[model samples]
Target chain A: MTNRILYVLALSAGLAVGPAAAETPVTIGMITTLSTKAGYLGEDIRDGFQLAIDQGGGKLGGVPVELVVDDDGRKPEKGKQIAERFIKHDKVKILTGIVFSNVAMAVVPKVVREGVFYISPNAGPSRLAGKGCDENYFNVAWQNDNLHEVVGQYVNDKGFKNVYLLAPNYPAGKDALAGFKRFYKGKIAGEVYTKLGQSDYAAELATLRAAKPDAVFFFLPGGMGINFLKQYAQAGLNETIPVFGPAFSFDERLLKAVGGAAVGVRNGSQWSHDLDNPANKAFVDAFRKVYDRTPTLYASQGYDAAHLIGSALAATGGSLSDMDAFRAALERADFDSVRGKFRFGPNHHPIQDLYIREVIETPEGTITNRIEAKVFTDHADAYASECQM
Target chain B: MLLILEQLMNGLQLGVMLFLMSAGLTLVFGIMQVINLAHGSFYMVGAYTAATVTQLTGSFLLGLLAALPAAAAVGMLVEAVVLRRLYSRDHLDQVLATFGLILFFNELTRMIWGRQPLFMDVPDWLSGTVELFPGAPYPSYRLAVIGMGILVAVFLYLLFTRTRLGMQIRAGASNREMIAALGVNIRFLYTLVFGLGAMLAGLAGVMAGPILAVEAGMGEEILILTFVVIVIGGIGSIRGALIAALLVGMVDTLGRVFLPGLFRLFLPVAEADGIGASLASMSVYILMAAILVWRPRGLFPAQI
Candidate 1:
């Protein structure tokens, strides 16, 4: 009796998943780092997608959609497995939300090989924005370099004579460093490549103290950033030197731990909570009401990805067979993006603006990211031209 | 000199916290003769519990108090159901089983907590900064962590030295056969020791949550360092785990701070910085490697 009841419960829950159009059912395969260190960002991305779908009244272009969430555990191998599952078993028409760049790198090729549309809401590795870009791979997020360029320009604009570069020792880390150096025309006193996912920052900070650079530019996200910021504050350099990075380096989730120490540090962002756009304002208000917290840039990308998918689905009249049609539909970028005026390039990455924001103290919570300056106005990513597709 | 002193203190503080983790891990491994790779999972569980309770109840003391028993109970349950069957198994089998436990616990956390990281707020009483030296204000929470570790260490020392159960545990460590012959309930004792070890790990976890985000698989991230601490201190030695953990923490903290400057003096600025950064990151692993080369049995072997 218990077994039958449990089985019935499971089946009923499974039946409850789709949005309600009752057209040809299409599955969206999403592989994200939902079970590991970067799970917080993954959850935000998931929430953004789900919330968009829920608020869209469960139908994308009069077609019911099913989403299959697979936890990649931030592993390339796991991501590949999910990609195969999506392609083979589920016949997923769209693949999305591989949060980590490495995981995206692992999964995107499968989506392309299978001729399914993969919209990367996050993990915009520079390679994809350039020669490696696939026609069907629409990125709702900016390339790794584009966001870094915002901070790079800000650092240059501030007229800092010298700066230190900090990032993890990985492909993404190297790319971020190169991206920062691409625009920040300053004498680099030091460039420290930390161990990937390194939990301690004392030694790196020691080198920084000795170098005494005008500022520190870091690209650590998730727990590594949290650890680095904590030790950096603990090392007593919070007051001495300024720090800056991409918006992912500090957000509502992170500010809660680093606290006042994370304050006074400036970072470049694609969207601040206080962005001046009606679409963005609506997103922020609606997101705040539902989640009871400010959505990070990751969430913003996710929201945009879902809306873009919905728009494309409507444009195609919910057709899955016409590959060119779906590709063209996604490229239109007609969705009301949380990040303003997002238009896709030939490489399928967004051409959008980036901002510089300061972490301010607010009465409601620790997050008070106010736009201190604007870096890119309708900026096209540097690598877009290389992407002939 | 001032910088040196400050960095050193930072190292000691980090090291002591690591000691708390290593102590629990080594205790379970040595006395129980069971390789509980899911030991860190207990810490993760404790921290998550503490964060949830504190968030719900708005009291750190109450949260902490709840965290201990909750973690202890989890530890006891794990021992009874999963670990009890594997006591007679080889280390390889034990590792595989416990490693499975780690994955299970991580997945369980995700399903329960919905994967959004919870930020634990520091209670007002412990949130104030204390001046460790003239003009140097350290956050009262971090100092509290140090104080907690010292207190736990003292308590552990007393428990092992003064109590009858401690004598039995020590006996169990030396000769399981002899202890079994002595008409003691080894099965019950194992469960109790596992629970105790779990409590220690949970204490470490709850304390750590206020600083770190209470998220899934945090245990796996720290598991590597905890392993390093165990290997350096010695397998099957609580004293060794404590000493080695603190040593590693200090070396790692101090190395990262000073290595680049030392390299900058010798090499070109960019070259020096890169090499120094990499070297500083690898310094702890290097220390571990060196220790292993010299003393395969570790700095303090538990016994013959």
Candidate 2:
């Protein structure tokens, strides 16, 4: 009797349902720098991305998705290997989530050549934005130099004529300082590039003190930023000359590590937790509820990446086969971003507003970023014009 | 001149921190003939424990106090279980085992504390800059670090030359089996030495927590530098570790500060900075190489 009832129900459902209602589950391969000193970055972005997926009921735009996460261990070779495994074994339709620019460069070129849609949650390297631009690549985050350029413009707006610049000696570091110089019409009192991950910044801090610039600008991220800020405050230079940086230095996670040292420091960012928008409020509230901590800019970017993918999937009906339709849907960017408003420029990088955030000390003795002013409006990246594609 | 002096002080501060790490590492190696790569894990443990305790109790001193014994206990436990098995093993085996221990401890820390770096604030009294000389101000926390390091060095010196335990340790370093044959409870001695080394590392970690980013795998980076210190200073020699650590610290600090300027005197702006940056990063290793060429057994090899 039960078998007869199941057969009748199955026959009724088959007769009622449309023939075109076949749903394909989308698989996204996320390769990031995890399981190292910089693992927190990957962890944050992963959490943020997962949070979005969770909030969307484990589906993007009414389509189910399987998210495969892998740790790159902050090595380019490891990242490349993981990318290959993702492409070959996993058959991941869309690739996203590389925390470091080096790893992004290593994996993006090879995988994008295979006709996979690559959406970056973080690390918008200039090479990918300019001559190396590809039709499939979409950077949900700002170009690497955007925040630093915002700082430069902010410094110029603040009327600081003499500024000292410092960053780690690397490609991103070079681009950061160059971006700063692009907008700031000021005398570079001194320019220095310290070694990457150099924890003891006393030598550089001493030189910074001696140079006596009106303002100091640095782009030391991760542990480097924590060390620099702590030492800078200890040296009492924070009392004399104002220090400015990109949000990478003064993010929520790092601000907690640096404690009171980073309080009152101005940094430029494309997103802040306190941005007053319905979409941002929902994202932030849901994120804090799930994670029990404030989300960083990285987390925001990851959330946006998920939403971007979701919008495209919704438009294209969970299918990545029609390249034109998928590309058009992604280009439309018809999703509510935590950053308020976002649009992909010609190079598929964000053309969004950058905000100046001040690290403020609350009455409860917690340090967090508070948006002070809009530094740039609808800012397109410098390399977008260079991208012939 | 003041700038030079300040930079020197900075160097001294870095040297002192490294001394704390190398002292423990050198002692463990000298006594046990065990290449414990997990020595840095003790440092990390100390820092993490201190951060957690400090956050719990709202007292920085209490956190530091807690950090020392926590790390020492961990060291003793690891020795009792894992390190004891590796003593008679070959150097390669010991290296492999200790490396596994490093990974184990790193994952363990991650499981307990999560992935984010912990924050340890400098105590209120030690949080500001103090005038080191006329018109020259320095961080009090750094000065305290220098002072504590010197005190530890002096204590270690006296302990080795003036105390029975120290003598036993020195004896063990020179001839382990002979000391065992001479009715010394060699096992207990090794455990004690290991604990002491762990305590020193823990102390360094506790002191360093306020300044450095206290996170997982923090030990590995500093561990390399500590190894360099031991190699350059002569392995298993505290005095050598001390001297070599100071030298390495100063060379590294001063090189980064002044090398670019020196290069600019001879080359164009871009070329000078490029060469200077690379050379500055390499100066400490260069010094290590030069020292090794002159003294292969290290500058102060212990008397056999």
Candidate 3:
């Protein structure tokens, strides 16, 4: 009787210890804007990230992971509070997924200082890419200015003599205009910074008409872009002036909302659904099958962020105790990115090919981006020189 | 000179839209003495309903027709169910209850429509531009909006001056208890007034649908402007709302257009642009404050 009782105790002890020793899932906290007007952006990022983990059978690169997601509602203060909870209560060692640059500025600097690893899926603010660059912070996305710089070069190549610029009055908006001016050697007819969430652009459009630039470049993302494009078309200015912008305004979902107004406009992006790559094809197909909608560039970044972290977890054997090994592994970035030819510059921002995409309506009447030309090959951010790291 | 004329037209167009929104809001506050923060939710409801209906039927007219009744029904239902009990409550209680309604309506739209904004194109008939003058071409759709605002204003004037229901509404705004004592079905009258106010907001929403992105929480932006219009024009007076809406619209539109240019004459371009943009956004609020100092009870306060 004594021998049998001891046997039962040993078996129960083995059952408890066996799984815990073999697989202790790493917890990753994701803070992104999932409410308000920009909620769809964060939804796509979350869906794409979750898709990668789902494909791995609740693991990434054979290492188990648990993703805890929260919405920031596009507020900097709310983002800080969520980050605090994730760090203190959840004991999350790694964090990712912030959609807005302002929220990232509030959260990333503080968390990275406390020794938590941050892999940004989107929102590569210039400040973080330059003098504020940190070793613990890894952006799996291009610098905020990279895509805008491509359009500037394209506009210059097209021989536009005068360009009118418009963007919201915010940090990212300033970065967009600055990036465009860096490559376009043309006369700036007007540089206007409108209210961030202003719905009516009638006043600005009237002023833009008066300036009479050869071309117009704007960086209004999400609903702001939709409002601008629709109103621009209605005002009958679209027929006379060619419109240009970055990929944020031309995403698949936003294109659907803007409809015919977005067609024929050219925008710059780092990745597209039509990119010729095995990894990209698979990711796009799988994303469509799962989400029932075409994935945006934001989704691609989220997928890449997950795969990058997975590769690092695999390299370090799922052990986060040695921060140095994990950091080195992340720096190596031995993952097949959907963008193709992805690498990190010294500032931990993407150095990859950027393409010019024209918004085209497919034969089926769905509007999407078609890659027209590659503007830059193996390009690094202009701010890399400013980074000491 | 052409640019100045076009800017004025833009100001006039924005003014009429604000009038549509504020007329209903002022009437509700004036007659019911209940603060409805969820007034914007009705505007959102109208936009969403119109967008969806237009997409399904391929008719902008039908969409506009459907939105009016839908918004009125919802407003009446809310007034009957949630707001009916709050009539005798303090202003703070009314404010709190209506604020909760805003969140509820926002989430409800998100659930029904999802996060993606619905697209509503300008009808082909109204999509063209008109030569307002020799050099200035303005969108015909904007002109239609201005005309619609004028039509509604005339309709309201005729109703208030010629109709018995309008007389009761004016009387009720001044003395609710007296109307009740005079055998007016006060509850039913309040509901009808609320519905009428909601219909005007719906008209504003339908007009804005093609011009703005029709998404959840779209009403909150215009709601703030509507409040300013009502406060500047005396809170329960339709005449006051019209004048105040136009004034606010002119100040806001002209300020946005010429402020930076005004500053450029004296200051460096970049610094001037920054300051001008900031001040332009504040122009309407400044006007409101200036008006209040001159008339503590608003420009056309309802006679007690």
Number of the predicted model whose lDDT against the real structure is largest:
3
lDDT of 2 by residue, A53-155 (tens): 9987899888788899999998999999988898889877699999989999998988888988899999999999999999999999989999999999999
lDDT of 2 at A54: 92
Q: Deviation in angstroms for A266 in model 1?
A: 3.0
* Lowest lDDT 10-residue stretch of candidate 1 chain A: A15-24
lDDT of 2 at B276: 95
lDDT per residue for candidate 3 within A121-201, as digits (tens), equals: 998888888999999999998899999999999999999999999998877888899999999999999999888888999
Off by over 4 Å in 2: A1-22
Q: What residue runs in model 3 are displaced by over 4 Å at the alpha carbon? A: A1-21
Top candidate (DockQ): 3
Which candidate, 1 or 3, would have the higher lDDT against the true structure? 3
Better of 1 and 2 by DockQ: 2
- What TM-score would each prediction reach against the true structure? 0.88, 0.96, 0.96
Indicate the residue-level lDDT of A65 in model 1.
Answer: 78
Candidate 1 Cα outliers beyond 4 Å, as residue runs: A1-22, A25-27, A61-66, A203-211, A231-236, A256-261, A288-293, A320-322, A366-368, B56-59, B121-144, B261-275
Q: Tell me model 1's lDDT, rounded to 2 decimals.
A: 0.82
For TM-score, candidate 2 versus 3, the one ahead is: 3
